[model samples]
Target: MDKVFLVAVGIGILSRIIMLNTDQRQYPAQPNILLSQLVLAFVASSLGALLVPALRDRAYTSITFLSLAAEQFRQVRENRRDSLQNLEDIQLVKRGEAFIEEIARTYEIRNYMCIITSLSTIGLYYLIIEELKIAKNTSLMISSIIGLALTLILKKLLKRESIGDIADVEIVKISFVDECIMKVGDLKGITNIGLKSDRERYLSRGIGIEIIPKDKDYTNAGILFDSGQRQTIVYNLYSRLGLYREHDEPAFVPLPRRNPKKESLIIAFIPMEKDEQKIIEAVKSCPVLASAKGKNLSLENYKIGKKGSV
Candidate 1:
């Protein structure tokens, strides 16, 4: 039993530790935050690893601590929300409330996934060793592999699509009318208001992109018009290609809007460098928002009457 417990705890700790150092979204979690998450993962895994022993020993009283962990995870979500909201005030591009909410829930759930993966590993080990009478060492090795595989599978299953996955992205030129109106892609023209220096800086080095949804019903699953998606796109671009620093001027910042006339989304921004392809790559790599993911629109979805959708 001691050997088995040690194996379970080891597997659990290693699995959850992955979350402490990695996040694809580039959420900018500080060092302190990363440390906090590492501690959280340890506690979660410890609880999950000890579950079988607690049950076998009739130490049911300790099981109630899982609920306390649940409450703590909930607080983690709230803390993430607060941290993001504070950052929103300072960020040149805001991540919007919806995106912030999505991120908060994600952090909370990831910890839960670590716990689940640990429990699965421990439970499978017992099933092999105790139920099937497998050798302990063999069971330990097989269970460890299966446990890590389960964590990866759960992570992949939980991921949503990227901007490049569902949309056609085109890097285009930022056009201007009378040096003040900005025409980005095929969308409606925007009026740029910047000082002479800022305008010169933006036009000479800026990048533009046109985002077209592949299908008509993409508003729900791949909505980029929301402030969060737009901010993410710009943040990616700025991080990759560098950003033009004219914060006060509207034209200096990346702006995205829905082209009501053509039903497309367009974004225009000034990068510190003038690499169009890099800009395209950055926008394409931006993560799709959970709320934005929607079912594709099709003839079957709407009433195909003599007219159109009713």
Candidate 2:
């Protein structure tokens, strides 16, 4: 029983710690924040692994501790939201409030997921070796390996979905209007742009893109170009292609504006470093939210997009 708890908790904590830096999901990488998360992961995993054994010994009172942990985990979501909301003020391509809430909620659920994973693996190990009367050492090694493999597999299968899965991305052209905004391609409002110098920079390096949503099972068309998803496209694009921006006069903004009448999306961004294929690749790599991923486009109303479809 002692060895089972130790190995299970140990493996669980180790799994979480290994993923701490890598599992940021666009969050900032502050050491203190990471440390706090690690501490939380440890507690959650410990409680989960311990609960099984504690029950065998008839320690029913230990279950109460879970209620306390649940409260703490709820606070984690609140803290994360407050932190990101504070940062949202300064970001040029901001993650909107909806996106922040979703991310925080995801983080909270992730901690619980770790707890469940640890508990399941260790509990199964206990059942095999002790309850089922398997060889102790052999069960230990085999169960540990299976636990680790399952952990990895779970992580792999639950990865974030990317934009390419739900939408079609393509290179397109839409010229700037008034040097401040492009109102072309059936765009509703002014496509806010920059000064002449800005145009020069954009002319030299910018790549125009068009995003089209495919039709099959869409409930709402607007989700295809939601503000949060647009922000995601901008984030991924900037990370890969970089950009030049001023307070109001910037080089690139990867916002996908709806051409409702024409039924298309237009994106005009000036890469800090000019590369057409890379920009296309970056757009493809944008993370698609669960809220946006499952819904399909309406097939009857729209045609599959083509070159300059708008």
Candidate 3:
């Protein structure tokens, strides 16, 4: 039982580490943040590993510890949210409330993943050893395999739908309307710039993109029109290609607007690298946030209801 517990805890920690991916987003990049996550992983794993043995011993009181773990995970979500919110003032492109909440919820859910992996591993070991009467060493090997396989499956399940999944992104030209108002592609009335210098910089260096939703019923259009989703897309692009503007330069800030009639989204911004392909790719790669997922209004029932109402 002791050996089984150790193996379960080790597998749980490994699962957490596997899921703690640091990409271009660079979240959990700081050493302290990384260390804190690992420590919580350890705690979550240990708690999970103890559950099988405690129940076998009829220690029902041990279940209370799981409740404590839930409380701790909730606190982790709050802490993550507070930390990100505090950094908002300093960020050139702020992550909106929807993005922040999504990130916090993700961190909380990951700790629970640790618990689940650990529990599954230890529970399997007991089943093989006590019921099937398998050899201890063989049971350990089989349980470890199962735990790691489950982790990989969960990782695949966690893969999010990117903007590319729902829309087609095209590189467009940044043009001016009436000299001062900037237009992305042919979609006009995006923003107004008073300074000629700003206008010149924009025309010379800015990248414009048009995102056209593929869904004929306009489900993807609804997603693109969300204010929070648009902000998240801008933030993803800014983070990847880097923004050309500074804190004081409001004229250069990236702006995204929707063409409601066409069911498309447009944005123009000056990138630090000035790579049009990179900008397009970044926009396509932006994850469609959970909070901003479009409703299935295209359902036959909904369409019938709309027609009836009209």
Candidate 4:
């Protein structure tokens, strides 16, 4: 599209130059007829240029959709293989799991339209130049070349921008309740966690544990009457805890105040059977889940009614 627009501008400049240099008196006196032909040629060329890009953009979108479909099929095949092999794979699989809504914000569809429109205008300019038979002026040819160059650059830039958007989509955040009870099922991250207003809603509804960083730390301290006593007490507590015992610490701990600001991505799965090892392995394998070095609450912890399932 951009290329077409540039072509139009180039042609327009060349046409203007030709008009300035050539004597209208030397040609047939039907000035109005010649003028109309030039105008029609310019319009048609510009429109054609724009239409090509628009169609191409649509084609790209279609390809993206097909690619997504193919990925889904691959996932289905993997699931079947795991099932027949009695492999411990997670049961639940979420369709379109890789797609994130943020991608739409980064990949501006309007850019495609702009490119198409510009190219169309360029095409019009080219047509006008050819129709006028003003071969002496080189401005039209030069401009057309410039337009083509600009279009190629614009395409590269747009593609780079699109790649960034794809990266953002792959890193979307997901939140979910972390449960202590083990169960076999697919779990996905929540888009939002209403910690203040809906904290109770999450708690009363069922398992309230949310996935959290594995490196999270909490400690209890007691004040002693003397500094020496306090120091001794702290030392004793630290020395008494064994390394193995520390490694076996529970995934969740009580907090003085709820802070739901955690970094994680959403994961969705389909559960086919009840197998704890398989479920845990699946969760661990999920891109969102695997990316975070944290313990997650299983879906079993949430006590939402059957009717409230997402």
Candidate 5:
């Protein structure tokens, strides 16, 4: 039981480490935040590792601690949401509420994942050793392999769709209207650049992109219409490429605007590095948030035609 407990805890922690993605766009980038998450993983794993042994010994009271752990995980989610919300004001481009909510929820889900991994590992090991009467060495090896496989499978299942899956992104020429108003592709009146210096900077450094929805039924267009979704895309661009503007330069801020008539999204921004391919790559890499999914309007087969409607 002790060996099984140790193996379960180790595999559980390993599973969490695999899932703990750290990148430029990843939240909880601070060292303290990362350390807190690791500690939580340890606690969750310990509880999970104890679950099987407690059950075998009929210590039903000990299993109640999982509920307490769940409450703590909920508190962690709230804390993450609060932290992100507080930091929004300082960000050049806000992550938007939907994105923040998703991040918080993901953190909670990951902790649950750690618990699940540990529990599964111990359960499998117990089954192999006690029920099947398998050799101890072989049982350990099989349980370890299966646990790792389960972790990878869960990770793949949790993968979210990216923006490129829903839309076609292309670099468009940045033009000017009245020599001051910015025009990205056919998108006009993006914003007025009254200062000649700002205008010149835009003319030289500006990058434009038109995101055309791939769905013929306009489902992707509906997703693009969401203000939070649009903000997320702009944030991705700014975060990945690095914004060019100073703290006071509101003019350089990127605003992703929708063309309702065309059912497309467009944006014009100046980055620290003027690489067109990189900008396109950034936007394409933006995740299609689960909360932003548009309801399928193409359910014509399910819809009963009105008496006078076509």
Candidate 6:
């Protein structure tokens, strides 16, 4: 796609240079020179039109990438902001994505209009020049400038919609051990965690685990296992099945087993409001606790290995 655009632009430039030289050589004698210049300008403008859609697509792709990167950074820094502020950031990014998509669609329309308008206008100007035999260099130059100025104005108008402000979200620090523990779940295996603002009706849940060795010092050993049964549980609770947002990707990390000696896992949860009924339902569904018959130990006791073996 990019190569094709470059080739078109090169051809347009070459045509314009040829037309310019010819016009200068035949100046003040041939009115056809004005028509030729208009044709070259129209060709150049049509070629330039391809850039609009390409730039719009590029901007949309960039925003999606940056938003995910910001989410990952927020996790690494352990930054925690108020629930409302976090919600606002999510909403803002959603709006920004939609705006970018709209801009791309509009550019598609504008590309079509530019091709048609340039061809039609050039044809009209050519007829006028040939019939009137007028040396209208001033008029042609003014029209060309006006057309380019309008394109620049439209580009600026879209720029405003594309630029968005990122809201500050809080981060909470936890030790590697704590990160692992929070990731562990009951026999039925469920780990509840996500942004505080996302727990509107139910807490987002996943299978949790912990990273080991901690070589990079980038993040604690906290990891959430999101697969099979646990992933479906999250989908049902959040009502966002299949449509995962970019911000959601950073909520979990991969914790592949690095060593056999480490027996403990640590996990952390961002405190948030959760639906009691959903929590109860999820707890009831856990396999380890499901058949305990009111004999389950406290979460702290379970974490410290004080309870009987599973």
Ranking by lDDT: 3, 5, 1, 2, 6, 4
- Candidate 6 per-residue lDDT, tens place, 100-171, comes to 233223323333334433333343334445576655564344434444444445444433210001111112
Give one digit per residue, the lDDT tens place, for model 2 in 1-310. 7887888887777767656644563454578888887888888889889888888899999899889889999999999999988987677667677667767876787787668767877777777877789898778777888878877876777667666665677776555655566543445343555567766655566667776665621323455667676676776676566666755754455566776654556777767776778777777666666665434444334344433323
How does residue 233 of candidate 3 score in lDDT? 91
TM of each candidate vs. truth = 0.86, 0.81, 0.92, 0.22, 0.91, 0.25
List per-prediction Cα lDDT, in the order shown: 0.71, 0.69, 0.84, 0.31, 0.83, 0.32
> Worst 10-residue stretch by lDDT in candidate 4?
217-226
Tens-digit lDDT track of model 1 for 110-213: 77876787788778888898889999889978888898888778767876677787567788766667767777766646656556766566567766777776
Q: Pick by lDDT: which candidate is best?
A: 3
In model 2, pairs of residues that clash are: 180-193, 181-191, 215-297, 216-297, 218-296
Q: lDDT of candidate 2?
A: 0.69
TM-score of 3: 0.92
Query: Which model is ahead, 1 or 5, in terms of TM-score?
Result: 5
| TM-score comparison, 1 vs 6, better candidate | 1
Winner on TM-score between 1 and 4 is 1
Clashes of 4: 35
Against the hidden true structure, what lDDT does model 5 obtain?
0.83
User: Which of 5 and 6 is the better model by lDDT?
Assistant: 5
Worst 10 residues of 1 by lDDT: 297-306
Q: Give the per-residue lDDT digits (tens) of candidate 4, residues 132-186.
A: 6554235345546665555455445433211111111121222345532221112
- Candidate 5 lDDT by residue in tens digits, 1-310: 7787888899888888888872224442778877887899999999988998899899999878999999999999999999999999999889999988888898899898889989998889889999899998799889988988988998888777778888888888887889798898888998888899998888899888999877433567777777888988998888878888888998888888876656689898888899988988888888877788855466322312223323
Q: At residue 117, what lDDT does model 6 achieve?
A: 34
Q: Model 3 over residues 64-164: C-alpha lDDT tens digits?
A: 99999999999999999999999999999988998888888888988988899999999999899999999999999999999999988887887788898
How many steric clashes between backbone atoms does each model show? 8, 5, 0, 35, 0, 22
